[model samples]
Target: MKPLLFMILLILFLPWTLRAGDATLVSGTVKSITGHPFPKADVHICDSEDGRPDVSAQVDGKGNFTISTAFRGRAYIVITAPHHRPVGHAIFLYGQPTLAVDAVLETYLSGTHVDSIQIIGDFNRFEFDNGILMTPDQNGLYSASIPSPKKRTRYQIVIYESKGAGPRSDEVRSINGIQYDELEYDSAGDYRSVINTTAPTTTVSFDVSKLPIAQGTGYLKLMDARERDLVATMMSIEKTIYNFQNAFIAAGTGYEEHAKLHDSLNTLLDADVEAYAKQTDDFQRELMTLRMLSYVELSGSLDQQQVGKAIGFATSIPPSSIAWSAYPTALGTLLKASGGNADTRAYLERVATQNMAVDVRPAALYFLVGHAADHHDTLRQVTFFRQLVENHPYNHFTTSARLSYVPRTEIVVGKSLPAFTFPDFEQPKQSITGSSLKGKFVLIDLWATWCGPCVEERDSLLKLYRQFEGPQFQIVSISLDSDPQAVRNFRKNGPEMPWQHVHLPGVWKSPPAELFEVATLPKIIVVNPEGKIIGVTNGLKGAGVDRIVARAMGQ
Candidate 1:
């Protein structure tokens, strides 16, 4: 289930309209499928199927709601109580005497077929416990009911049995009639419990460890909780897709089974996520998959026609959707590949104009800046930046306005490298300008000490640098470290590589940082001898970076 905080934040921007008429009195109580009354549940009435609000209320302590408002047409009513599954039903709102309806919520459970399973998942928004307990019925079936709870939820069931009877309170639990280490429920743990959507059986597996555990002995500890149902199963699979997508892009190989599962899970996830459209996690996963698919073409592994098809698929995504952080990242890649074509630019422009709940405007602005810079369209960048700065004057992103849109005159790519100066490691002033290296290919690696991915790729950069080292090929490294001591430490203790290196002082506010739109670390930019920009790539680690360097250097 989406976090309440996240959902509230998303709803902050929902459009609302006021309507008046002869009032119709509607009252109802929210109940779970198991016949439990829901308390403090939100009740909403919308005039349209798209959920345009007409009137809303919250269930009282007695799980009852009363909405007296004027209406002319039919409206849809929705019930969402905390910690329970959400319920939706239609209401006929007219100048009538009264309207009454009963809303029922489904019982939330992690999975089926566990002797004693601990529940964990997104339902409690990853909280270890939301107090959703399952008890076996007379028919030998485990069941629990939650009243009209929040809209979306993802939950997991961990079954625990007793191996030996020492005391009622023991940490280690049993599985399959055997006892082993209790399931470690760490809030920060990397494992996300996945349930089998295809079957009633609750399947538990961790991403960090592929080992499958079942319910049995002592007391089972469950980790990872969300709203219970098929939604949780779909979220788990979406996460799997994202993981595999990243793995494939990094390794330049495909995982067929994972991909198939990803597609299969996406069908259910799409409907579930859209039904509860206020969350960004699902959007994040989808955008990531789209970006990964784009990489299959951007890496030159696929032809331009293939790239076009991918872009078409990307454009097919709904327009109102925003990906928070991933939105800009995806936009950047698409712009680079499609050169801001009509369809692609339309999407970019829409994102730029939309009211983003997250701080994704900066990324959108940066993509536009990059596009304007690449095309030398100063007017576009200037207009966009000015609008951004003016509209969001107090926004944190405004600080980078100057660097976001640089003067075209100062940025020359094809001629001898522009005259630019950066501070040396010893503060002795080291510089690289057009006059110094007029006829050599230079690869600039914009990195920082604090970035783990940057550090991991250091060896690959070194190897790529060494491979192309000659009169025509050179490598320059720039560090965006706030503390000079940190850069010095990295220089002394980090990967040992012989290359011209300099630190630009501030961490992210450095001049070059905003100028180059270095949102994340480890940015690689290829420049010809004359300083003509060739290619720019980021998030390249290990062999991924190696391949980029090799292809760039014609090796």
Candidate 2:
């Protein structure tokens, strides 16, 4: 839907105010995974039919709540408890004066299913090998007694499962799973045990009957048929994806498995979301679009195929103004850094070059530029970088970075290095001006004591300086550490970096940092003897640094 139309429909969903006496009252008990009362849960009575104003209430410490809505008994309810997964979506309570809803939510560990349950947590220093296997009693019920830890412990349930010639998952549980859309919508907090429990705390039980989605009983009954079926499909998707991940992790490699799971997740975006979009008004679609941005990011490490699918999915979203504002920046990062395939590159090129997709163009322009840089396709890198700068001169993505702060064209090979200067770290009298380093190939090393990569590269940089520092070659290491003392301390305690040193010490805000537009480190800028730009790189280190500097020096 067009954003304008979406906004227009929102007016229809606005609530019609009524007196407090005529309000619909919703009362509920918030139950933890253990079937005990949970305090401080939030219940929201929403106009599910339309996106009207929601009446919300926070449960008291006793885990009971009563909330009144202006709507006359037609509403949808959502429940959230602190540090716990939320329950209720498509749980529309219609034409009821006063209603009672007892909600049951599970810990993060509850999602992982297994034939046998064992707990691994901070109590065991998160050691999977020494996990405490729960004892099964009857009807698939399991129980485990843990010696209470001094502080709250986070954990996950694992079972004995194995795949040959892979990490011994049975011996030490795997921390991998498929992230279904439902869980993505619901906040996934760290699985934490009850805080500061005293002695006589009852054994935490996993009664299969009481479990919500696990047993397909508790909360499913509350959801109407349509919602129940939708959720069931979502759950099934999660299980299939979960099994795929387990197999992938256990066997340690499964390209096809990864691709299939990736496609299944995307189906949630396409089939499920599209079907729902048709059912709801444009206002809800707008909200869904916003959520779609958040939803796309739910997965952990992506395979190349997965990355391609992700790009395709995000690119397909219609560019609404509000959605585009922050989306492009993230989208740009994704484009520039990840995915390698014909579809990925093809989609990116279209987005970048297509003037109509202004919001998306910034990112599409970004992907190919970085792809060129990664393969050392210097010509394409320069071409794409120039396009990125020219096409996005008045870029919209920078207006608010969800509220970040993009690209180096000025310092690319064949361009003249912009004039800049910085004061010496040890001596205020001495300055390392761009003009002073003339008639020599200069390596402007933008680094910091705090940057791990920068610190790690000190030895290699020192070697580079020693090998090439001559009348025709000079190396200037600029320190962007916030404090000059950190550099001094690092120099004193760590590897000897005996090159020409200049401290441009406001970090990124430092004068030379602005001149270079250095966003990441360790940044290496190589310039030839005549002072025209030689090359620029973000993480060109180890053997690559020597090669980069040597090529610039014509040796």
Candidate 3:
């Protein structure tokens, strides 16, 4: 009986023991683009690049390194080296004891005089000094091995020399075959290198030229070659018109040039859309018409007659058609284009009451609420929000609608200013806090490096500061930039703003911004000598700012 009981216990606990001790072994070799073995490369193995690594290793003379960790499933492998572009890859390590990843490092520098190189990105928060440095070899190539970033992560590289650091470089892909656009460090810049570690959705890439004709044509097996040819020709014309419109907008072409291009494109698009609308009763006709109308609306060059025609065309589409899903968006555009007239408002109200498709109703309600809020119709806004919540309780828009009802604290006269502390951009040790500015009237300028209007407002602010130059008045400018280096570089090269500048690197979500409830750029908040909030406005020049300051100074 004792032997049988022991056997049963071993059988029950054996599975648990195996699971508790499940360790994965990951090993890899590093190589240069020329197939030479890469040595002394820093290797990091982590669940994500943004997060701390579970294990770190350096490649040996033979360009090989290994790490053993309890982490299972998917893993990221990030490698870095001097003079070589940093690259990363994602791999799965489940149901196996070991996984191997061999990767190539690309050379980023072509000329000499570069003493060192480092990478700065979301992984390092874009700090100039706080980055992973690469090790150089006799061949002038650098290498390092570090854990990889999580799947779908983005990052940028920064090259440094004896004078100072160069601007951040573009993101490098793992394959090294194709080149992506350079990463932008500006506030509104949308360039970042992405690491995709999953299987692609489609085996073949979509062809842009064929996209217009192929979309809805998949179901028309009975159509003749002649009919299909006509559809293809119309699609080709639509594509040409769209391409010209996009080019003109991107180039910032003059109004005269723009108007000429717009007329030519609009004529072609209108003719094609009218011909197709008469021929087809299918969803394709509705989709094509909506696309043409959206282009005109986005161009911002539409006349009154054009706007009226787009509205009528949008309303003609049936609610049950798949193409009807985009009608709400088109309607919203027309409503805005018509300058929110009575007719447009009535049409929007009618659409809001109709039993529209699930995918389109939330957008229609959101536009209605926005229009009401823009006009300061608080009651109408609240009613729409309530209707949206009651009708679509589980929709994604419901949460946003509920949050909209939460009243934000407005920074105005007679309220104690919110307290905050931030590192001075020039001197990190000496902090600029709310408590430090007690005896002086402070004009707190919250700005970002990427905001054009914010930079433009600096000159006026400087003039104001010089006008009231004394011990009692001070201007403290706080920068909400993500990278400290970007702020530093801008100060070195950009226009001079002579004032007490503090660098708080969180962009829009920085601590001071959160404390002051700043939602727009060039936000100026004036605090009195006793730390009482006196006034708040989007611009510093106009809107009774001078009056508020003069009163505070007892002028």
Candidate 4:
């Protein structure tokens, strides 16, 4: 009986002992490129999601620190120091009792005067003000440590100067030694930088100088070659189509020439798709697919037979192909060009019902639902949105469909302008309110400095402003920049619109934007003398702006 009791007790305690031993001790040393230790550098061990530090410690004057935690899965270590770029690394703690990491810090030198630096990222929801400050050393290097309660793989370091130094500017720079998407911009117009701590390190390096190309022409040369090749092929097709169209117009016939040109283009597109399908790289295949779709759109109108052929071509690509996402847009364009025939509808229905990839099915369904919405078929729109939400409850499309059901504050024509108060970009203390612009025909331009389209539209906006620069008309240019300095920079260096500019630093989530449901930028809302919204459009192309201003001024 004594032996049996002992055996049971041992079994019960063994599991507890094993669990207790799973706790990990993570230690690291941070040094600068100059071989100097980062004294009192901020070291954070964070949870993978929330970015809250679980265990934190400071590097001593010798640049050494240690943290012990019960975390048994993946986590992140973030190191920040003054004058040095913030460093983050993803680490896994399973099957290890202790782990040591040695990091070499790089300095932040963007040829700008920076009074302070802080680290911010997705782990903390990218809140600019909720940044972790770094302490600067005598040598101009800074360091700090915080306990990381979550794990994250990406972050950005913001360098800020003093507030009164010509608009309180801040510069966000990418972390070195990491590859990130060049086109990933946040709502605030800040570029996103990614760090892959999960990937294995490779030490292979190659010299590009040995290649038969000029120093700066490596990527440019490749881009030029691609552009030339595409343009040559497109021009050849364009010449044939041009001649065919001219002949058809002159003779009031020649359908055979049109058919031949269409067939030839289709054949070329098919061959390109087949070649792209053979590529091992998914991104390359997707690029080729996009090129082919562009070719189709530019070729000409598609008849019933050609529409069927295009749909067949799209469906021929396997659901597993990465190029599948491109098909929805291609199919939607073809359907629109084909005037939405029953055959096209059936093809879309087949895609939606098929056992396709998770992404493909919802995309097909979304196109159909979007088509219904475009036609103002409210009943069909609601029904399809409901179906999407019910069938794919966890899909991203379902979330969008759910939001579509929510009642939004309509800023439509004949409605009163939503009341808002924002500070002037040049003078933050002075407020600009909706009531102040009463009795004036206001062109309320909601825009951001970093938006390329918005910047391009500046020329058109200035032309309108100059055309109607009187007491009856005013251009209230509202900037959606998070950093006030960005607006100031644009005002000083970019186009001088000479209009009443307002700056409210919330970007897309600003009060005015949220109230008006301003999802896309360069949104222009024209208000009459009665302070009622008269015209709202996402674009201000051609003489449309002049006509709107003229109508508003009662010209």
Number of the top candidate by TM-score? 4
Q: What is the C-alpha RMSD of each candidate to the true structure, in Å?
A: 17.0, 17.7, 18.6, 17.9
Off by over 4 Å in 4: 1-286, 291-320, 324-371, 392-407, 450-452, 538-550
- Candidate 1: 10-residue stretch with minimal lDDT: 218-227
Off by over 4 Å in 1: 1-307, 322-326, 355-362, 394-401, 408-444, 448-474, 481-506, 509-555
Q: What is the lDDT of residue 445 in candidate 3?
A: 85
- Candidate 1 accuracy as TM-score: 0.38
Q: Write the per-residue lDDT of candidate 2 for residues 78-140, one digit (tens) a residue.
A: 676543445554332223466566777664234334456676555676555687887988667
Prediction-by-prediction clash tally: 39, 1, 19, 24
Report the lDDT of model 2 for residue 462: 74
Off by over 4 Å in 3: 1-376, 384-405, 409-413, 493-495, 538-541, 544-555
Residues 268-342, candidate 1: write the lDDT tens digits: 334433443443555444444454443432243334554565566556555434332322345666766776876
C-alpha-based local distance difference test score of model 4: 0.55
Query: What's the TM for model 3?
Result: 0.40
Clashes of 1: 39
Give me the displacement of residue 397 in model 2, in angstroms: 7.1
Q: Name the 10 consecutive residues with the lowest summed lDDT in model 4.
A: 213-222
Task: Estimate the TM-score of every prediction.
Answer: 0.38, 0.35, 0.40, 0.45
lDDT of each: 0.50, 0.53, 0.54, 0.55
